[model samples]
Target: MTIRILLDTDIGPDCDDVGAVAVLHALEKLGEVRIAGMTHCTSSQWGAGCLDALNRFYGRGDIPIGTLTMPGFLDGDSGYAKYNKGITLGYPNRYQTEPAPDAVETMRKVLAEGEDGETVIVAIGPLINVMNLLESEGDLYSPLNGMQLVSAKVSMLIAMGGHFPAGKEWNFEMHPASAAYVVAKWPTPIVFSGFEIGAPIHTGRSLTADLPDTHPLRKAYEWYVGEGETRHSWDLTAVLYAARGHHPFWELESGTATVDAQTGANDWKHNPNGNHAYLKAITSPSLVAEVLDNLMTR
Candidate 1:
């Protein structure tokens, strides 16, 4: 059965987000998933633009793209201006317009529209949007917010956040409070594609070399790979794991997660208290190469 997926992403930090979208499109083609909606959680002017560009590239422009209201940070600077400054670097023409709809509201609408227990949330960015949903609607969705939500409204929350062994990672670090809130309060099963899993799967080379510049994916990839360097496929791993349960590069484990209240680090231990999937990294260079090749070709 095809899983209904709501993709929450932060596309501008690195170009691999583009590749992640490509992988999602491929999964849709394979009939393994459906694109319910997309929420951009970077809380930047360019965040929405990045989402729009990717959706347009994949011929999914009609997909609802919502922007977060929370601010974003830079490499190490957790300031609003850092995100605003980064916006100047990509698709300047698109940022001059008004922002898209509120991401939190869009998420609520999507959840309302989904059939009971049928939606899967694949979060490949900051946890702000999901956190907002949980905090605002937790009481009303007590049954559908925690483990019950996991079994009912949500099949799984495949998140590309946190780090293995509970260290700092950008996504989790950016809004550590929100991350902690969502993981602790969420009522569903979560599968984390942390930095340990995605950081290693770097793209070897451009797969769009043969395609003309006019090709949407090709143009997006070209623009993304500005410095003639292969990008890291951080978000794509989450996409792959979500669409195809086995990637030959990840070992899955059932564990309970404990969130550090002060720091956003997540500690996972084997337990029955919560049903969360922690991904352990494995060697799968071949699988990465094959997926990259197929995405570029298709």
Candidate 2:
């Protein structure tokens, strides 16, 4: 059976998110997964447009795209808006003019519509949207609350955040409170693909070299890392493991993970029965990059 995936991303800040979406689309075309929905956790106005443009580029233009509506998230003016602008301007996007629904509401609707224990959520962004979803009360979609709905529908959460045994990462640090809350209270098993797992595994050069200039993936990589240059496959790693379970590429270390809400610092303690686990690289970075690049350029 193909895995049903709901992607939560902050696509504007990093080009890796675009690569990640491309990887997901590639797997989708191969009958490995179905992209149920996409949500952006950033406040960037162009976020939904970027997502919609990329989905359209992959010929999945009808996929729903939602954006973070909650206040106090990342700003609309991000340094990476240039790439997002390029995508929205250059590609065919419906959301560029139509406003997207709230991320929390979109997530709730998707989860409610999903089969029990079948939806895998790949979050490659800040935890704000997720935190809001978890703390949300029952709505029209389902009577079950956020945590209950997640426990019922979600099989696993594959998150690309944090640094290994200890340290801070961008996703976690961007919204520390949400990270802390989600880490402490999330109902399902979460597998984190940490910074160390993706940092050395570079990609994008192949995508830019092979894909046409009109392709959003090529444009994103070209503008972010320059033409024929590589970038870390951070978000792509999470989406990869979410679609295909860990085997040849990685190992898992089960532990209790904690993030200081104030500082965004993270630590892990070994616990055989813990619901949280972080990925440990087993395959060489170059090999993994080859796998990801092939998928991206496919």
Candidate 3:
């Protein structure tokens, strides 16, 4: 059976996000998963545009794309706005555009209509959308929290957020309150792809080099890769794990993650809460290289 997936991404900040989307498209072609929706949680307008471009590139333009009402981080001008302008200038009408919807409504509708036990939520951005969904419409659904929603409607949540033993990841830090709420209350199995996972997997190398100039993935990468050259593929790793189930380098653990109220540190414990899945560590280099190579070529 194909896994139905909802991809929540903040695509533009780093080039790896585009790479992640590319990888996801490849997985869809292989029939490993069916993308139910794509939501953007970043402040980058360019990111949203990039996502639209990507969906159109793969001939999946009908896939719904939702943007966050507010930006997650404050990096100069909003990333979402910047991305929007950039992508509009670059691709023009290469993709469709839609206003951001109520995320809770979108998730509820998607999960309700999807095949039971075949859905997975792969989050590569902040937990705002998921958190909002839980806060507003969670009780209406079977699961009262994001975690519970996962356990009930999803097979698993392969998230590209949070740091494992350490606690300084950008996604977690961007919205600590939401992260705390989610990690503590979510019910389904979770596999966390953290900052460390992407460290060894650097971009601006083989993946871009191998792609032809007309390739959409290459165009997206070219826009984001600047300065120091290589960028982290944080989101792509989560996508890989979700599509492939197991990569050679990742080590999984069943545990509950508790966010420190003061420091925002995520402390994962092996208590039998029956509501957590923690990715303790990853075999960074091989997994990153393998995923990137596969995405660039395929």
Candidate 4:
């Protein structure tokens, strides 16, 4: 079955989100999955613009993109993004100088148009847009409320957030209320790639060595964390599970994951029928790094 994926990301702060996008595109080229759409939960025009530029690099400039009303950023560059800042390429992008569409509407339209129980939503950053999408009401496209729409259409929600076993991470810590609400009330099953799972497995070193100078991914990687430094495969791991599932790369720890009210630390209680599970890294980090390197270079 072709896994249809809708990606929600906060791509500017880290390079793995860029790597994850490259992985998803490579999978799509292999007919392993379909790119339904992408949304940004961070408020940076340059970030959205970079995503558009990357999509164009993959020859998918036409894919729908949306940005949240309240992005987690205020008024500064998120280290990278500004991909087209210093370079002068005849690149094809719409958001470099243009505005992005409303992300909630984009989510609604993408979900409403797809076949029920066939679409997978992978969120690799903060849960703002997903939370917004869940709490949103019906409009011109469907009669169902946000919760009802997700129940009818989405098959699964795979999120890369939380530092499981007890710790506060950026994704949940940024917005605890939304994270708590999503964890408790989301309609579909959730699989979290916690802080520990993706920390050891690294990628992006190959991109610095392999990809050409003119490539946008290479530029972004180089700009994000300097050349040749491998970034933790946090977002990439989540996208991998979304495309392939936990198999040779990782194992599943099934449980009910709850977020602490104030601290945002996560506690997972083992339960077989629980709607939640976390990825336990089983594949060698070096080996997984090789796999991601191959995908990143693609």
Inter-residue clash pairs, candidate 4: none
Off by over 4 Å in 1: 71-96, 137-152, 214-228
Tell me the deviation in Å of residue 180 in model 1.
1.1
Tens-digit lDDT string for candidate 4 (174-259): 77777888998999999999988789987887776798987877887777778888788899989989888999988998889998
Task: Compute the lDDT of residue 165 as modeled in candidate 2.
Answer: 88
Per-candidate TM vs. native? 0.83, 0.97, 0.85, 0.94
Q: How would you encode candidate 1's per-residue C-alpha lDDT over 144-243 as one tens digit per residue?
A: 4433434466767898887875677778876788788778777778888888776666663655565555554455555556523566666888888887
Off-target runs (Cα >4 Å) in candidate 3 are 43-46, 71-84, 92-98, 138-151, 261-263, 271-274, 280-284
Model 3 is weakest, by summed lDDT over 10 consecutive residues, at 74-83
Model 1, C-alpha of 256: deviation from truth (Å): 1.4
Q: For each candidate in the order shown, give its overall lDDT on alpha carbons.
A: 0.70, 0.90, 0.68, 0.83
User: What is the alpha-carbon RMSD of candidate 1 to the true structure?
Assistant: 4.1
Q: What lDDT does model 4 reach?
A: 0.83
Error of 4 at 62 (Å): 1.6
lDDT of 2 by residue, 1-298 (tens): 8999999999888899999999999999999999999999988878888999989888999887789976556664557585887898778898777778999999999999988998999999999999999998999999999999999999988889999889999999988999999999989999999999999999987765588777778888888888899999999999999878888999999989999999777999999899999999887999989999999999
Listing every candidate in turn, what is its Cα RMSD in Å to the true structure after a full C-alpha superposition? 4.1, 1.1, 3.4, 2.0
Best by lDDT: 2
Give the distance in Å from residue 99's predicted Cα in candidate 3 to where it truly belongs. 2.7
